[model samples]
Target: MSEHRPVETWLTDMDGVLVHEEQAIPGAADFVQALQASGKRFLVLTNNSIFTPRDLRARLLASGIDVPEDALWTSALATAQFLADQRGGGSAYVVGEAGLLTAMHDIGFVMTERDPDYVVLGETRTYSFESITRAIRLIEKGARFIATNPDPSGPSPFGTLPATGSVAALISTATGRQPYYVGKPNPLMMRSALNRLDAHSETTIMVGDRMDTDIISGLEAGLRTVLVLTGSTRREQVETFPYRPSRIVDSVADLIRFVDHGKPATH
Candidate 1:
């Protein structure tokens, strides 16, 4: 018998939910420590595919989050695992950086010569005409195309930059074929996460700062969702949206408080 009740596992977001640009959010570490004290499990989830688990773990450690790679899951890793499970050890034409390549390679996929089995795109600081053109050509040749994420833009200290959706649009224009998105707002990453963590959807709470991608994704996956308005999502913008989160907080700093006020459950 299974209890369709909430448990102590917290599948949290990284970039926006826990940190602001580079610094840790106020009381975020304390909250995590509190959760740890309760013998709960937590996994940091991020849509940004530019950093590997090791890379993000180190960065978070420097910022005082003290996370391990086993506790982290990125869109890049999920994208790789999704393909490897679906297509096995097929060669792929990559248009991302070292992190994206490394994740796929670690997951049993090989980057091969042009006209490879798939076209995998991710975040690259140096996305140029040549890079886009190469991806476009591969997609045109009937390569199975995929994007690590479909975010319209990237978050920066100042504002937005070219994200996966921007690059995907360029390829879509050229090839008339849509790249499969493996990040939030899609089931690919969430389903993969459930398998990797061996977590039941009923007890999982997808926590993030964005509503469209993170919240909707959790809802779509039949999991609970908590929205922290410490980043991209604003209160005013949320009222206009049709779907509302299960719970909302000012930041991860108040997650424990939110949990305290939550409806009781059994597991």
Candidate 2:
């Protein structure tokens, strides 16, 4: 791998990169604190649109991480921002939870089912057949389709549960209209995050566990990327991808030294 420029900003994935199964990965807290102490602009990203930032921050705090609400970003927020930019103050027929709804509401979007301008889908533990049916009907009636992310399943103690992507596939099959996914692997989400931080791609580093989502999205958005083995993607799985991250490490624990020294170690 080629040497990367000095990283002036950081973007990291939440689930696998920082925490897993509701537990904070080792060194995750120190990494965050290092960023804070260095005064580097950073944001924690998540494809899950299930919780608002405040909710997520509280959850992180419980696990021994102290990320502020403002430092956390969700696909729900990106989806809401996309809608607000596309067509300000539009109405949507939403199928999701408080996080998605709150994001939409924060952006001044009206939630409705009667002739809405869009049929928005998000992650939810309990997916109502009635609500999905309504979304399909709305899409069939020419409402634009939007989804928060394209994750097929999410982890839980019970088992892997179907997520936004699975449901979006169902809706697509019914309406023959694919939703515009507004989360990871979509460069739009990364750009939106960078915009929020007022950071430039050249000086930013995206740390993530998944090659398909985090690394690819960062690469497409012109940011250097790091693949951490602490999350969803493993070391062996990374070589199977067409491209490579700028660096790969055992975990976030391995990167603290680089952060402290002021530049990633040359590969």
Candidate 3:
């Protein structure tokens, strides 16, 4: 028997739950609209740090999902929030795209290569060897290491490509320093989202596709978790994990009724 309170807020992963390969998954648009109509505080989250919320909004709009800009959260935004709270106005040597760069800039972080307070890593389609060498040297010079997310690889039309985690590993091998990741699988990300929404964990639900990152993080943060099959994890793979989600549904479509009723689904 579950002891959770009625859900008043929602935190859902963007890629697997709402979209797959830039296309809106079945019932994703309707799910977003339902949440909006219910007047519930919700956020669509992503671990991808390559694009800002505005950019992501445009992408989702093209796919027919209507999510407001402020309702969208990214690893880059979480990373910026983490940095701002930890050390205000700190400078960093960054290796990422506009999303990450803009977040740091918004927080008044000075971008530099010399004597930086941190070496910040994020996702980018074109990772330059030149920038990587600089990052390695900066870490060796005692700059703290930070990465937006620990995802080892990202999806590309051609195939899987190395992402922030893989690069962070390389930098660690070179400098003997591991980076502090500020995205999913880290309960700090969940706590940060909760703080952003002013939502309590007991009254909030986390909807995601991956068991390792999404389910685990939500469970650790004291939020009930739902695993949807519309993204990464296959149904048969659920039991392999040491921990389990509170519910396993086919997709966001199945969650619409619960949005209004706030009742636990029959498992």
Candidate 4:
């Protein structure tokens, strides 16, 4: 591979790269601190739309990862931004938590079950059957369907639980209308993050644990991608994918020196 420009900005996945199950991964805090000390333009990305950035910040802080509230990018924010840009200040029937609701409200979207313009779906632990039925009925009556991400399941101590994608599937089956996803693996989210940072893709690096979502999204967005083994994808699974990340490392700790010196980390 040819040499590229020195990375001036950074984008990283939140769950596997920084923390797992509410615990900070090893060297994750130092990695974030390095980015802050270097004044690098950075954003922590997550497909989970269950909580607002402020809410996530508090969670991360409790886990010993001190990330700024504004620096955290979530699918909920992306969905709201997309809606705001597409049709400003529209009403919607949202099936999500505070993160999605707050984002929609901030953009001046009126949440109502009466002839809404869109039916927005996002991550939530509690998915009421009555609300879903209303969303299905509303979509059948001419409302657009929008989902945060395409993740079918989410992790829990008990086991895997149905996520937004699974719920979206049910809605699709009922209404026969597919939703436009606004999160990872859909380059729209990456493009929106770049726009938010005023950063160009060529000078930015996307660090993520999952190849299917993070790597593909970054590649499609024209940014360098690094896959770390600390998350979902193991080292052996890389070859199965038709595409490849620019670099692969064991964990975020390996990239700390690279962040400080502008040199690539040892593979």
As a whole number from 0 to 100, the lDDT of residue 258 in candidate 3 is 83
lDDT, candidate 2, residue 64?
95
Model 2 Cα displacement at 211 (Å)? 0.4
Q: Can you give the lDDT of residue 119 in candidate 1?
A: 91
For all candidates in order, the CA lDDT equals 0.80, 0.92, 0.93, 0.94
Q: After best superposition, candidate 4 residue 252: deviation in angstroms?
A: 0.4
In model 2, what is the error at residue 213, expressed in angstroms? 0.4
Predicted structure 4, TM vs. truth:
0.98
- Per-residue accuracy of model 1 over 101-195 as CA lDDT, tens digit each: 99988888878756689999998777889878888887778798899999888877777789888989989988999989999889667777887
List the candidate numbers ranked by lDDT, top first: 4, 3, 2, 1
lDDT of 1 at 255: 70
Q: What's the residue-level lDDT of 57 in candidate 4?
A: 98
Candidates 1 and 2: which is better by TM-score?
A: 2
Worst 10 residues of 2 by lDDT: 258-267
Residue-wise C-alpha lDDT for candidate 4, range 1-267, written one tens digit per residue: 248777889999999999999989999999999999999899999999999999999999999999999999999999999999999989999999999999999999999999999999998999999999999999999999999999999999999999999999999999899999999999999999999999999989999999999999999999999999999999999999999999999999888988866555657
Candidate 3 positional error at 152, Å: 0.6
Candidate 3, overall lDDT? Answer: 0.93
List runs of model 3 lying over 4 Å from the truth. none
lDDT of 3 at 261: 68
